[model samples]
Target chain A: GAGVSQSPSNKVTEKGKDVELRCDPISGHTALYWYRQSLGQGLEFLIYFQGNSAPDKSGLPSDRFSAERTGGSVSTLTIQRTQQEDSAVYLCASSLWMGGPEAFFGQGTRLTVV
Target chain B: SQQGEEDPQALSIQEGENATMNCSYKTSINNLQWYRQNSGRGLVHLILIRSNEREKHSGRLRVTLDTSKKSSSLLITASRAADTASYFCATDALQGAQKLVFGQGTRLTINP
Candidate 1:
């Protein structure tokens, strides 16, 4: 793809339900990132991936939040037993390589847990 | 907790005026980058300044880094209404933490 792509631009899920957000990064990019933004809030780092391995998962809010990237191309963020506070926009970004340079972002997935 | 903080949480300025946003971080960084977000969706990279470099420029954007003070600033010259959006600063920690930590963005509104 010419740019990072995220699926399901918007999602509304009932509390306690599970939702999955997907991301397809630019070709050949070795570094990927996941971030979350609440209503009018700052971007919160969730995870970072180099290749298919996540080097930093310290930002994951809780055990309910998990993510996986395969073949170093597409990634998925899964939020289990979602709560109302989990409502936010999940963003994905890719860079040529870890610490290589700037990152390209996807349009993001807006998840609303009601 | 490694995230940075942006100053003047919200700013409003007229078109053609210069707008400036500042960011401060708590840890040593290998580089600092500035990004712009429109409509709160995707973010576009604006500029990056290496720790060793004091300043850099891209078109109408100017970025400066003060590694000694662990701070950075973005200056948009002759701002346009189209420039109305949120600006963020991200840092690549020098401690080998390759993840980019972002600041609470500065929302700049340009009035026509």
Candidate 2:
């Protein structure tokens, strides 16, 4: 079975630029989540989507951080006006709802804001 | 914000030796999960223990949870050099809507 997949393994951009990271969840997975990992730091929750319900954006660091999961399958995380603090590994995960409770992760997109 | 804090930021052990890591978290949780990440790779789920359950096992990995103490521990038996990686503990807090709050992580180095 194919696992979660993310595109653009690495991205380098200037400050104030915008970047988009893409994630494709496994087939039949209904729960999707995005997290950030800074160097030598813990995983930081960013956003989550479950089915057609509203997405949880509480963990988003700022208004510049936004994510959208379209058609209940693929998702894109966009950081508008990126800052050096936003530079980190963006990870995507998918699960069969919380009932199953095991999340499959993607390789992640390493974003570098110079 | 991170809810869990792992002890011993780094550890080194000889191959075939056992290793243990502990995590302490604030707030009640629905479940506690352990994940392993190789260098420059995505995290892989190791084991999960519900707040109600005390312990879980997957192959050489063993996880124990103590809801009273708001803590959890992961023990790896007969660790191999390939097992060298970073381990993290994540908590599914009772208040959060199924989000996993992770700890700072422990870097394990298995010396062969």
Top candidate on DockQ is: 1
Task: Compute the lDDT of residue B2 as modeled in candidate 1.
Answer: 64
DockQ scores of all models, one per candidate = 0.85, 0.65
lDDT of 1 by residue, A1-114 (tens): 899999999999999999999999999999999999987889999998997564588899999999988888899999999999999999999999876599999999999999
- Model 1 spans with C-alpha error above 4 angstroms: A52-54
lDDT of 2 by residue, B26-106 (tens): 988888899999875699998889889998898999898988988899999999999999999988767657677789899
TM-score of every candidate: 0.97, 0.95
Report the lDDT tens digits of candidate 2 across residue range A1-114.
Answer: 499999899999999999999999999999999999998777888999999989989999999999999999999999999999998999999999852488899999999999
- Weakest lDDT window of 10 consecutive positions for candidate 1 chain B: B92-101
Here, model 2's chain A TM-score works out at: 0.96
Q: iRMS values in order, in angstroms?
A: 0.7, 1.6
Off by over 4 Å in 2: none
Compared with the true structure, all predictions reach lDDT values of 0.92, 0.90
